[model samples]
Target chain A: MIVFVSCIILFLIGLYAIVTKRNLIKIAIGFAFIEYAVNLLFALIGFKRGALAPIITQIDKPHNFVDPIPQALVLTAIVIALGTTALMLTVILRIYNRYKTFDIAEIRKLKG
Target chain B: MLFIPLLFALPLITAFVIPILGKIYKPLVWIVTTVVSFILFIIALYGVAVTQEIPMSVYKMGNWPPPLGIVMAFDSFSAFMVLMISIIVFTTSLFSLRYLSRFTGQWKFYTLFMLMTAGMMGISITGDLFNMFVFLEIAAISSYALVAFGIEGEELEASFKYMVMGEIGGLTFLLAIALIYAKTSTLNLADISNSMQVIRGTTFFWMIIGMMLFAFSIKAGLVPFHTWAPDAYPAAPAPISSL
Candidate 1:
């Protein structure tokens, strides 16, 4: 329970950084932090009380195996994060090219 | 029932196949993806129709029976989500046709798009929590890359922001899975649900609910947790945004 709460806390910290940071790159870093927190929470979820690897083999019977779902979920989530991160980087590059800096406040030339 | 898994599989196959084909012919990418999306949309609706009278639909994977083998099933909630995923995917593809011209890598866009579609479909149909996470990641990673597609500073910022929040959600979900494992010793969702049904009122049960609710809500991007969306959505190319 404490572990779960800590994960949430880590998530909040990342959120704070993303929200408060002025540098675009820093904000992106904040977002990365948030992803780490959530993935950590999930990994903890898959951990067994006293289990071994989730793989099932014949010679050695597996007992108390951890959940494979979270690991699977993590794989997918990581991919999604990777895609998002790549996309973000692309946008940041464009933004940097158009503007002179990675600062968010100065680059809003598109205001309605 | 088993055809349910195919909804996830088909698009994934398409995601991989089209990119390879796109290396040879560019136009092949859109057609293949569009057709795949159309098929999935039809199939999802069909699934709902077939289950009109029943309470739920279950598809055991690899001919394995329920409670013993892996399951891919859906109730009303999942069916609705499937509908959401496919419609969004189709509309996004339509939107992409015009909007993606500004971008150079047409094939890359479609690849991520199909991957996102497949991931969402996988999440909506799977009867295992871990599989749900995997699918969630597939959708997420694609979305992340999509967000950063333009490589503009603002887009990168948005992508990073989105990535941070998304990762947190993934971690929380992982924690939940771990806790549940500690208690129930299983990860197949149906079995988990069945097991959960027995201990509905315990502190542990609430723990499960808390983890899932927190994770999905973040993914869905509801009000308080929705800060990254406005930035990311606008930063993304219109078609990518739609995708």
Candidate 2:
């Protein structure tokens, strides 16, 4: 329970950084923070009190194992996070090239 | 049930094979991606028809039963989403063939786009909540990076903003999943529902409600969270923005 709340808190911290901050790289990092927090939460979800790995054992009885679903999901989430982080970085690099700044406040060239 | 896995496999294989052929033939990626997505759309339509009911078929992974292995099920709602996702992928690929020339890495767009498609398909197909979370992150993160591919200040800024919101949504979902797992001792969606039913009116319901709502709300980019769109979209080269 405490762990779960802390995840939420970390997420909020990222959110605050994203919303309130103006540095482009900072915002991107803030987004990464949020992504990591979410992935952590997903991994935490499949955990059990005393469950073991879901792999089939040689001698042990077919019981007492951790949920494999969350583990699988976490692997998938990590890959997804990698893809997104890479994309974000590329875009940030482009933005910097065009405007010559990583500060969000100065990049108001797209306001409507 | 079987069609669900095909969704991932077909696109994944196509995504991989197309890149190789793209270097030699040029039109290969477009042709292969289109054909695969068309097939997927046709299958998704059939799936939608078969799964017309509220509770549709569930395909357990690797022949293992629920609560042990992953399950892929489709109700009418999910089938509808699948249909739309297929269309989105198809259209995006078609558009990208011409639209992505402004950027240097053409294969990267296709890779990310297909991965995003597969991720969305996984999310729609899986009946397990945690599985959905994984797929959701896959889709969300890819889109986030896609937004910033241009690497302009505006593109980067928008991607950053989108990432922030997406991260928050992810956390909310994780917290909710953890809370549920702790209480039910089961991670399967149907199983969790079954176990939680006994405690539906209690904090369990509230926890689920809070978690899913936050995540989905962020995903849909509903009213409150739509702020990231204008900046990122225009900042990205037109094709990605359109995508």
Candidate 3:
């Protein structure tokens, strides 16, 4: 329960960064932070108290294995996060190129 | 059985194969994408037929049962979603043929477009929670790239904003999946739904629902989460905006 609470705290911190930060890069980093926090939360969920890694070298017997589904899902999520982060960075680069500034306050062309 | 997965597989194969063919004949790209979408539409119609007769169809990969292996289940809802997607994809592919001439690397645009289509279809049909996440990400990453397709300043900024919101939603979804798995020890939707009957009134359950609601609200562009939608919709090309 404490672990899950702490994970939500990490998520809130990232949300704070996104809401408060002025720099586009910092906001992008905030997004990355959220991804990491959630991924960490997921990895922790599948942990068994004293279980071994969920790998079976021999089929004779397997017992007390940690759940592997969350691990696999987290891996896929990480790869997808990588793609989004790379694309976000590239977009930030272009924003810097045209606006000549990283501050979100100054990029006022699309204000609603 | 074969057509259940083929709805997504056909377009996925075409997405990769068309790029190679595009280098050989520039005009072949649009033709192939349009035709693939049309074929998928036909397949979706057939799926509608199958679903009408049986009500639900489940296809297990590698012949593994529902709890142990990845499953793709088609019901009326999934068939409906697929049908809608194929119709949009077919028309957009045809429309983009004329609209995309102003942009360079038209082939790349079509490639990403087809990938997004496949991803959306996969998401709608998948019965496993993790598979849905993977497909959601595939669709999302492509949309981010497509929004910034022009490489212009406004477009890039919008795409960045959209990407941040989207990533947050995706991560939250992952967290919810984790919580659910911890509780139920299963990732299959049908299994989870069946197991969910016994578990009730837990904080984790509420958290799962809350997180999923937040995540999908962002994805669906609900009122509060509408911040990124306006900017992104206008910035992307017409076909992708509609998609």
Question: Which parts of model 3 have CA positions greater than 4 angstroms off?
Answer: none
Best by TM-score: 3
**Higher-lDDT candidate of 2 and 3:** 3
DockQ of all candidate complexes: 0.29, 0.47, 0.72
**Residue range A52-86, candidate 2, lDDT tens digits:** 77788676566877777667766766676676667
Writing each residue's lDDT as its tens digit, candidate 2 over B138-180 gives 7777777677676555566677667766766775786677677
Candidate achieving higher TM-score, 1 or 3 = 3
Q: lDDT of all predictions, in order shown? A: 0.77, 0.74, 0.89
- Give the number of the best model, judged by DockQ: 3
* lDDT (C-alpha) at residue A51 in model 1: 84
Q: Native-vs-model 3 lDDT?
A: 0.89
List candidate 2 segments past 4 Å from native. Answer: A1-16, A28-83, B52-55, B95-104, B149-153, B235-243
Candidate 1 or 2, higher TM-score?
Answer: 2
| lDDT per residue (tens digit) for residues B42-82 in model 1 | 98788777667666878877787766566887788888888
